[model samples]
Each structure stands twice: as structure tokens, then as C-alpha cells.
Target: MSSEIEELRKEIENIDKQLIELLSKRLKIAAKIGEIKSKVGRDITDEKREQKVREYWYTYARNTGIPDSLVDNILPILFSYSKMVQINPGKKKNITIIGYGGMARSLASLFSLVGHNVVITGRNKEKAERLASEFRFVYMDLDSALNWGEYIILALSPSSMDYIIKISPKFSNKVVMDIFSSKNEVFSQLEKLSEIYSFNYISTHPLFGPLLYPVGERIVLIPSKSTKNLEEIITFWRECGLNTTVSSVEEHEKAMAIVQVLAHFYILGLDRSVEILKKEFKIENLSDFFTTNFREINKIIEKVNNILPVILEIQKSNPYAYKVREIGVNELQKIRKELGE
Candidate 1:
């Protein structure tokens, strides 16, 4: 039995080796295709092609009796890495990030991964140096980083507007962007600052949370009064493997009202209600009875709990917040009435 187990392990090791070789060959082909795309001025990502590939994987998985769950889990990682290999940032820019927080680290990781020069700078030199070392990026003082960077990203929160105001003059002639989730107030403030500082302000909101190596995520770009070189900015984000959407400030606020405000509000209520009911009903060992759907929801609840402050800020800042919340409450009431609760 032990001898048979050893043989099986050896066979698995051999398969792993073949898998590595095939992945390497696939990436090499992707790199060559990237070169062709660069020469022809085509974008790196082809959504249609990706969809076809996903269908092929699903069909093959079904044929081989492989679980759909496995394909679902693995395909995104494969797609991300494939796009990573195909990224050809033709003229890498020096990007300076103005905060050393999670979002800053995420952007630094992506810029460094795609061969762009990134500098981490903030008031806290120690934190900046630590984050820079994680990606082998440069750690510079705020002023030096601003001067050195061709593009500047303000990764700080809306509450830090005073700090932003103080440094506004240093942004003269620079292309500056922000990654604020709620843009109603922040966008207007930044737009006004751009006019006074003589800088090009392009508002941006990264759709994904602050996860390292957030390849293939979507980022919304809103061109402000001083925005120039819009096309160049789009290409820069695409080269970093992010899908870009250009939106107006009003449109962005409305969308976030539904996407972030309403959804997070519902989840926050659900999280609190679940705990109250769990205790009220004296339920215990709930994990043992968790269905797949409940488990998925629990994960979302966990994520929301982790970022409560950001969630609350979005809830407060969206222009349509009050109306959206009223609608949400009414819907909940309707559901309760239907259930005779």
C-alpha cells in the first residue's frame, strides 16, 4: 500500500511538471501576441476572446467530469495571469502615490508588476519605506516624489482634503488623479483645486477593493475641467491590466448610490439582524448548517464588516443616499408584509 501511494505521488509530481511547461509555453505565445497588439495599436484585453476561452474551459471541464466549481475558481486567476503576460506598457511612466495605505500598496504592486517606476510617499516615512520595500519601489519624501512623478495619485481619503489643499501648489503642471469611492463632494473639491493649482485633474475610482495585484479590475475615470491627455490616461490604466470606464461626475454618483450605498446598507442590516436573531432564537453551531448561499452571503458580510468606515462614508456621501435608503426600507417593508411578518 505504501509503495502504491509513493507511485501515485510520483505520477502527480510528473503531471505538475507538465502543467508548468504548458503554462510557460502559453505565456510565451501571449507575450508574442502582446507585441503584435502593441505594433498594431490594439488593447491588451479582448473580452470576446476571453468569453470564448471561458466557454471552452467549461465545456472541456464538463466533458472530463471536472466540477464547475473548480473551473470557476481557477479561470479568473488564469485570465489575470494571461493578461499580465500580455501587458506591454510602451513608455512606462513614473507614478507617485501620495499615501501608504492599502490602496497605495495595491497600486504600487500593479505598477511595479507592469514595469512602471513607482514611488511611495506620505507624511509617515517609515510606513512609506515599508510599503515601497514590499514592491521594490522607491520611497521618497512627498515634495521630491511629486516633482519626480509624471503622474500623481492621491490615495488619501476625503477627510485628508486639508493636506491635499496644502500640497495643491506642488501639483502644478502634473497630471493628478484620485481614487475616492464617493465622488460627489470630493470631485468638485479636487476640480476647484486643479483650476487654482494649474494642474490637470482626472478623477478616478477603482472599482475593486484594496487587494494586492488587482489585475483585470475596473476603474472609473471622470475627466474634470482641467483634464487633458484623456486617451493617454486610459492607455496607462489598460497597460496595468485594469478595465477603464469614462463617466461624468453625476453619473458616477448615481451608479455608486445603487452599487455601493444600497447594497452595503442592506448587507449591514442583514449582518446586525442575523446576530440579534441568532441570540434571540438561541441558535448555536450555525456553521454546521450553513448552505452554500448562506456561506457566500457570510463572506460578503465579513468583507463589509472589515470596511465599515468606508461603507459608512459611501452611505453618507452619495447624493442619492437618502432616497436610495428610503427605497430600500420600503422594499424591506413590502417583503415583510408579503411574508405576513
Candidate 2:
């Protein structure tokens, strides 16, 4: 309507076009760097380099009067895309994922994106087929997939031990890995089965949630008694753009007890408390008064609720769960006394 407004809009459009062109040029250079790294056998993610780049972005943002919030939000996404372009997998292997759940889809997406041959299989053939078709992968029967795959990922939950037990005999000589959250009891069970049936069992825990193309995510790898070719397995995950950390069963369980069990326990309590307070105070439209920190906490609450079963399972299975929760409650009581509440 106004000439000044129209002129400003045109200028913004031109700037947008220039930004897109600059991004394309940057990605092209990143691809060339990826080529060099691959030739030299270097990992895709260079953490020190990433930190320097992040500092540079922040310094530039400060000099340009850009908000720290903008830098915080945009840098991770830019870094993720940069890593996605730099992924150059080596000697693709046949990966069979044995579930049609969120974690299954996430791994399938990452493996397929990195040029691996993937097959989806489970008892529910229809769900398996649908997930496979999403990534142009084939869906095979349980026995057929187990026979065909060189690496089998048991993406099912820890409660699915019966199903895992039934199929334990077929895993002979195959490199089998289970992505269970808590490994206290499950690890021992699987390790014993691996020894009995003569399979290489490697326990794994993905540190991130079910997200497609989860570049730069971290995965914890715990080796069982029968684990072999450990270096090769590490390389496989590295090539798929995941940061891998090796830990023992005890260390892994302790870490999860603090990280997952304690955190979820507090969040679940907060969620229930929030609901009780809301109903007691006759508070409606409480979101309108939410602060930025509360908004973030609410997001975590929503995510925890979405996967309540998994969260509860971790709480139940983690050996340190009782200790962690007791400490958490004691800390809250101390805070309450300090506040004179």
C-alpha cells in the first residue's frame, strides 16, 4: 500500500536470495572438505573445530548487534546441516532393524541416508512394511531378515525380553545389538544368551530421542562378553554421523540412573504437581503467563509424557533409581525449609 513499505519488502526479498546463494556456496565447500576427510580416514564431526566456529558466530553476532538467542537457535541447525552434507559412509553393510517404533524409524532414516542396505522386520508385518516403504527399504519376515542381515538391531523395548529370548537361538554368528535404555538386567541376560547361542552381542543406547536424520547425536556403546570387531562397529556409527562413546555395563547404568531416571522422576512429579495446582487454583489459560524457562520445561514435560512407558521403564530398571529419587526428594525438602514454606 505504501511506497516505502513496498520498497523495504523488495530489499528484504533480494537479501533472502543472496543468503540462499551464499548457503549453497558454503555447502559446496563443506562437501569438498568431506572428500578430503574421507580420503584421510578422519571422522565427520570435529568438536574442537565446531567450538571455534560457534565462538566465532557468537562474537560476530555480538558485533552485529544480533541477539544471543538467535545465535543459540540457528547455530545448532546450521551445524547439523553442515554435518549432514559431510557424511561419507564407507563399505555399506546390511542393517536389519527389528521394530517399527520411533527409535526404529530414526535409525532406519540415518542408515538409509548414509547409503546402507536396510531391512525392516517384526511380528507386525503391516507396520514393518509401512516403515520400510517410507525409506524405500524392503520388509522381510523375522527369520528371513535375521538370516539376511549381517548386523541386527533389536529396537524393541526391554519388556520384549520374551520375544528376544525366542529369537536368541537364531542370532548365531551375527553381530546383534540391542538399543535398550536401561542395561542393568537386560545386559546380563543378553550377554548370557550371546554366549549360549554364539552371537556377538553389543549393547547400545541412543542419547537422543526419535528424530529423523539425527545428525551429530550421541550413542553409548557397551561391549558384551561376546563382542568382537569393536573398532569396526565404532567406525560404522561414526560414518553415520553419530558421536560414539564406549562404556561398561555398570558405568552405563549409573549414568542412565542419573541422567534419565532422576531427570524423568523430577519432571513427572512437576507435571503432576502442575496439574494438581491448576485444578486447585481454578487456573485456566495458564500458558498465557508462562515465562521462557517455564515454556522450555513444559516442552520437556510434554515429551516425557509422550513416552511415559519408556520413562517409567527406565526408572524401574535402573539400579540406582531409589537412591536418586531419595536424594531428589531430600533436596526439594531442603529447598522448602530454606524458603520457609
Candidate 3:
């Protein structure tokens, strides 16, 4: 029995080597495509082509007796790698990221992947150094980072924004951006500071979490009066495998009122209600009996709980937050009345 097991393991290892070789060939082909795309000034991601490929994979999977779910799981990873290989930045940037948090790590990972020099800096030098070491980035004091960097990303929490104002002098003539979701007062303050300090200010909200590489996430850019190289910045982000949307500060705030404010408001309320119901019903665990919808909701609830601080900050700062929450309450009340609950 041991001899048979060893023989089967050897066969598996041989297949794994063949798979690696095939993947290498695939990536080489993708690199060539990237070269051609660069010459033609085409974007790295071709969604239509990707969709066609997915459809082909689906049909091929069905015909070959392979599980459709396996194809679903593998295609996104393949697409991410394909985009990674295809993206050719016009110039390597000297990027300084403030805050050694998940978002900082995510951005640093992308920068390292795309051959950019990255510096991570914050109040906690040790934490910054730890995060920088992960991606071969430099860890430095804020003054040094600001001096060395061409582009600066403020990945700090909203509460830590005072650092920007305090160190305003270091930002002279540099391109700067903040990744705060709720723009309201913070945007105005940053814009004013940029003017006072003579720096390029572009407010940005990364419409995704701190996932590594984040190869096809959307980032909304709200250009202030001081923003001059908007097109150049957009091209830079596109080459980094991010889709960019230009929006006014007002429009961005209004949209987030609906997206973050309304959604998080209800999710928070729902989470509490779930906890209360569980206690009232004396139910200790619902995982064993969860339906697909319930499981998906549970995942969302978990994510919300983890990011509650940022959610609460958005809830407080968004101008239209109260109106949206009022609408949510009214809708829920109406449904309860109709159901006579």
C-alpha cells in the first residue's frame, strides 16, 4: 500500500511540473500581447475579450465533464495575472505612502509588482519598517519620504489627517492624494492646504478594500482647483491596473451618501437586530443552518464589523446621511406595516 501511494504521489508531482510549464508559456504569450498593446496604445484590460474567453471556458468545461464552478474559480485568477503581465507603466514612480495599514500594504504590493520605488512612513517608524520590508520598499521619516517621493498617497485614517496639516511644508510642488471615502470637510481642508502649501491635490477614494495587488478595482478621483495633471494621473492609475473615475467633490459626496452612508447604516442596524433576535430566540449558533443568502449576509456583516470605525466616521460626516437613513427607516416601517408585524 505504501509503494502504491508513493507511485501516485510521483505521478501528481509530474503533472504539477507540466502545469507550471504551461503557465509559464501562457504568461510569456501574455507578455508579447502586452508589447503589441503598448505599441497600439491600448489599455491592459480588455473586458470584452475576457468575457468571450469566459464563455469559451464555460462551454469547454461543460463538454469536457469538468465542474463549472472550478472554471469560475480559476478564471478570475488567470485574468488578474494576465493584467499584471500586460500593464506597462509609462514611467516608474517614486511613491510615498503614509500609514502602515492594510491599504498601505495593498498599494505597496502593487507598486513593487509594477517596478516602482515605494516608501512607507508614519508616526510609528517600526510598523512602517515592517510593512516596507514585505515589499522591498523603504521605510523613512515623513520628512525624508516626502522629500524622496514624487507621488504621495495619504493612506492614514481620517482621524490622523492632522498630520497632513502639520507637515504641510513637506508637500511643496509634489503630487498628493488622499484615499478617504467620505470627502465632505476633509476634502475642502486638504484642498485648502494644498493651495496654501503649493502642492497638487487630487482627492481619491479607492472603491475597494485592502486586497493585495487589487488588479482591477475602481478608484474615484476628485480633482481640486490645484490639480493640473489630471490626465497624466489617470493614465498612471490605468497602467497600475485600476479604473479611474473623475468626479466633483459634491457629486462624490452625494454618491457616497447612497453607497456607503445608506448601505452601512442599514447593515449596522441589521447586525444589531440579528444579535437581538438571536438572544431573544435563545439561538447560540446559526451557521449550521444558514442558507446561501444568510451565509452571504453573514460575510458582509463580518466585514462591516471589522471596519465599523470607518463606517461610523462616514455616517457622521456625509451631509445626506440622515436623509438616506430616514428613507431606510421609512421603507422598513412600511414593509413591517404591510406584513402586519
How does residue 126 of candidate 1 score in lDDT? 99
Q: By how many angstroms RMSD does model 2 differ from the true structure?
A: 2.1
Clashing pairs in 3: none
Each prediction's whole-model lDDT (CA): 0.90, 0.92, 0.88
User: lDDT by residue for model 1 over 186-216, one digit each (tens)?
Assistant: 8888899999989999999999888888876
Write candidate 2's Cα lDDT for 7-34 as tens digits: 9999999999999999999888887887
Q: What is the TM-score of each candidate against the true structure?
A: 0.93, 0.93, 0.89
- The lDDT-based order of candidates, best leading, equals 2, 1, 3
For model 1, name the residue pairs that clash.
none
Q: Comparing candidate 2 with candidate 3, which one achieves the higher lDDT?
A: 2
Tens-digit per-residue lDDT, 292-316, candidate 3: 7889898999998898888899999
- List candidate 3 stretches off by more than 4 Å: 1-21, 36-49, 337-341
Give the lowest summed-lDDT range of ten residues in model 2: 35-44
Q: What is the Å distance of residue 321 in model 3 from its true position? A: 1.2
List the candidate 1 regions with Cα displacement exceeding 4 Å: 1-13, 36-49
